[model samples]
Target: MYNLRRFILKHHFVILFILLEVISILLLARSQNFHRNRLVSGTNVVVGNIHEMGSDVGGYFHLRQANKQLAEENALLRKQISVVTDTATNTYTLLDHDTIYEYIPARVVNNSTGMANNYIVINKGKVDGIKRDMGVISSEGIVGVVTDVSLHYASVMSLLHSKSFVGVRFKNSQQLASLRWNTGNYRFGMVEDIPTHVELHKGDTVLTSSYSFIFPEDMMVGTVEDPSVSSTDALNKAEIRFATNFATLRHVYVIHNLHKPELDSLKANFLDK
Candidate 1:
């Protein structure tokens, strides 16, 4: 208390000067509207600058999450490019006017790959016209499909899931098969039921087959990391390294085929017979 009083006495003159300056400014502002407006404007500018700096600091702290989101979006775009390339290269069946598969772009708002039943949440929903069963893809490759939705958000069954299955085929042969992840590797999976007769090679691209409505023909899935056959097995299985980087997934495009419902209804009716 003694030190505090001593310090205040020491700076008393300077404190009085600052108080008088503030009082004078307040009187001038009260007497002149222009002066008051100018003071307020200057204060606003300083406050805005301070707010911007604080926001930038916060954003810097969130870079990891932001980067992950960007990675997912990039993966979706890669999937689109692969689809176009496959369709153009004569390796995939080109969709005519009657084809059903389509694409809808979306951003990943929530995602988790560490769970037993992993799922991805996108920022698109019924309001965005996203429906269940539509294929979800990224620039890297196929992410999954829209499973559930609300007004502005939808859930996706990521391709990394053990239960997830989609029609897939070798790029060159176009032979159709089911593709699934067995939790063995995040970036690689085994392409099953590849016929032993079809010439197999390493580094060959694999894509979605035309038979599946969930994905358009030629949508990229992965590349053949290893092509090998068991000595006693009659079929070949290729170790496929997925093009889509699930670890860094962000944005996804939901595929909404205009003809999907009709095609699915017809198939369902036929099966009822």
Candidate 2:
């Protein structure tokens, strides 16, 4: 109590001056409508900034949880979409395994798009029921196919690979085309074997064909781009802008085909013979 009194006495003039300044400012603000409004708005701005900063900090901490939640939701939503659209095919037949499959959400741990044989590494593996030849896709479109698997990781053959070829259907006539990556540019691919009568418009979207053994039928692949400079052959072909950007791939889904083993066995026994 004695120390407090001494401190107060020593700084009494400074304390009085500060209090008077504050009181005068308050009085002036109260006297002027414009000043009062300015003071309130200034306080509101400061408070709003503080709240925004707090919200940003909180959101940064919850990003991982939010991503996991989004991955789960993505898988569920894609599956639902497939189920809803699988039966609306025109001439293409949806395979039996197409209806008997599940989606395993994964994260791209590593990716390379600058090579002739680009590959992507995902965080799901055999333990998570991820096997070889499973189709991988992103929110935007088809990504790749699982080529190798381990206990906790798997390698995917990216669509940008030189040898990668996917069967795609055009939106104009539902006619099938072969999607192959030969352009060194990762953003574009070549669509071949399109029927000459089926006119392809620029920016027309292409989708996974019903004959796709790896990916689900009717999934988006990309939009048709400009005429292909590299395609010099006589076949009807065009360039397409790939929907999934390989350079920015982060999250993906691995498709689980329940009848793959049976199909493989049948192929081995009958087709091979």
Candidate 3:
């Protein structure tokens, strides 16, 4: 206690000066309008900056939730679009009047684009109504077909796989082609079976054909690029810039076709006969 008292006594002048300076500043800020306004403005600036930083941090954490919400919205929009298009075109109408395809929102838990047979794993599976042969897509375009499903997860055969073949048609000429991954580029695939006589040009849009039971008709696949005639002179092929960037895929929707089973059963019986 004696040593503490001595130490305080030795520094009393300096301590007193600091305290007086603080008080003087406070008094000046309170008495002067300019000083008071400056202090308030400074406080507001600091507070505003802090609040903005907090908001940015909070938004960063909510990104996944936002993405899920967006996926759901997209699914709803897609369904609505299909209904509208079908009604306008007077396409096939069912007795039940329900949309032929329903979308189940899911997140891509795993994905591979750097392999011969790349597959995607989604967070939803059998429990979520995901089944084998279901179509998977993102907001941009068609992704793949569901090949396997578990209780809580499903695997998709990505369009980038070598074995993948999707029936696609040109948007302008309606020329049909088979889309397949060429195993050479991730950003591009090959469109084959287009006749040499059919008109094709670079940047022509390719879309899912009506013949594909997996994907809804007219879903975008890619744009035509580097079109060429095969050596056989009987067929034409073109490179397509895929619409979906598989490397950065995140959210996807699993498509459930209500009439798929009935259609498959009918086809099976006919084939057997």
RMSD, each candidate, Å? Answer: 19.1, 21.4, 21.0
Model 3, global lDDT: 0.78
Off by over 4 Å in 1: 1-102, 229-233
lDDT of 3 by residue, 167-227 (tens): 9999999888899997467789999988877888889999999998899999989898777
Query: Which candidate, 1 or 2, would have the higher lDDT against the true structure?
Result: 2
Cα lDDT for residue 18, candidate 2: 98
All models: lDDT?
A: 0.73, 0.77, 0.78
* Model 2 per-residue lDDT tens digits across residues 1-273: 999999999999999999999998987556343122323321233443454455456556657855875787679889987976877667666676457778898876667799877777676677899877899998788998877666666778889887788999988778888999988999999998865656777889899998777988888899999744344455688899998878766768898877778777987899777
TM-score of 3: 0.68
Tens digits of per-residue lDDT for model 1 on 106-160? 7665566665456676666777899877888886688887666666667677787
Higher-TM-score candidate of 1 and 3: 3
Off by over 4 Å in 2: 1-99, 227-232
lDDT, candidate 3, at 191? 90
